[model samples]
Target: MKKHIFKLLAFSLVALLAIGAQADDGFFSREGKYNGEDRGKPVMPTQLNATWKQECSACHMAFPPGLLPATSWTKLMTGLDKHFGADASLSAAQASEISAFLTKNASNRWTAKTAPLRITEAAWFKAKHNEREVASNVWKRPAVKGPWNCSACHAGADSGDFNEHGVRIPK
Candidate 1:
């Protein structure tokens, strides 16, 4: 009986450690493509470019490149000077580095041929936030303002988590 109890305790400890590690590493962050679903699954890129983080985030949250397809990223980057009514122009080197990073990590599960410039315009995004899951007025709230304000409800949006389970919409 004593030996069995000790073995059980050891197994439990190992299991707990594994779970802790996953959480610490953002394993449950909903930000990646798995199979064909656009589930809020985190996929930490091997390399997150500094330029992309700084430049793109200056005007708004630096959306995860995995949220869009390569074609979409190329189009967006090519017209950075007129980026959504703002002059988000970057130096040639900076733009090149950011473009490469974005294209490389673009969504793998985006099967549609159309590449939308805005992430919110994507079919998957629309499907996920249909009227059934979100009220019409929710987008008009002062805190929400628009669909682009992902972090307004998604606590981990900045870190590319976007896990629905962790959402906390502001009043």
Candidate 2:
């Protein structure tokens, strides 16, 4: 009985967090609150620039700009030709616009001096997905592939709504 109660409580807590976060309509949420005001705030992409989406998503999911820092976006944009062992080169104009968008929306909580090229490499990412939370063999599963594939587990990943309540790890 005690074990069942504990599980129910845990599930309820997670559900509340997921729903409450999305329902927050504070002043910050009302306004186009960029500049890290909604940095750690639980919200989806309030505004997704079209150019960034079209260009970046052409190769892969245009990862939320908030996933990285300004410096990291700059570096990644500058080296688009050699993006992660692939030739994802973009025109100068496109790169500049996308860079500006990413930098403007970069993670407000990220304070590390080193800007990570991959979201998986970020310290916060590692902390959130530590060995204790995720089993070692989970990564080897064909469905999961690797940590970079956010949509593998997070159904709302494309929209940047990674609420834990909605996560469904693929079998």
Candidate 3:
């Protein structure tokens, strides 16, 4: 059963990737794609850089400032380890500090998903355009290395940022 599921997932991911190639051209115009309005600046006060480094930098690179709302970052930090793929354990003190920092700099506070590496939430479904379960499972696979390991394929991932022009995927 596991093997069959993995195979199905792999097939699904491949199909999604092929589709994503075409999908990118118009991904921005879709409904859930953030249009950069309404949201204010990140919640994390810019001065809280120290907290961000102490907490978030250890795992997936610090999120691009434009990506999530301040509220979302607050929610995500409070729920680390339960995070997408890895376990990022934090002491209570550390958690508190990081949470404060993220709430200041997160996406919810901003207008939209800024500098996002992947299409999330509603935009995700549109981008997937029917290829959902398989791609999600594939992301859970060892080969794909979690959904947010955007650095693996996207150029300049280590720069602590993401941009559409940098995207590249295997054929």
lDDT of 3 at 62: 60
Candidate 1 global CA lDDT score: 0.77
Question: Best to worst by lDDT, what's the order?
Answer: 1, 2, 3
Q: Give TM per candidate.
A: 0.74, 0.72, 0.50
Clashing pairs in 2: none
Candidate 3 accuracy as TM-score: 0.50
Q: State model 2's lDDT.
A: 0.73
Evaluated at residue 137, the lDDT of candidate 1 is 94
Across 56-155, the per-residue lDDT of candidate 2 in tens digits comes to 8886678987777778888888888888899988888888888888888887665446588888876556655678767778877899988888888888
| Candidate 3 per-residue lDDT over residues 11-65, each given as its tens digit | 9997786577434332344543434422233222345466666566676656554
For residue 2, give model 1's deviation from the true position in Å.
57
lDDT of each: 0.77, 0.73, 0.53
Model 1 per-residue lDDT at 2: 100
Count of clashing pairs, candidate 2: 0
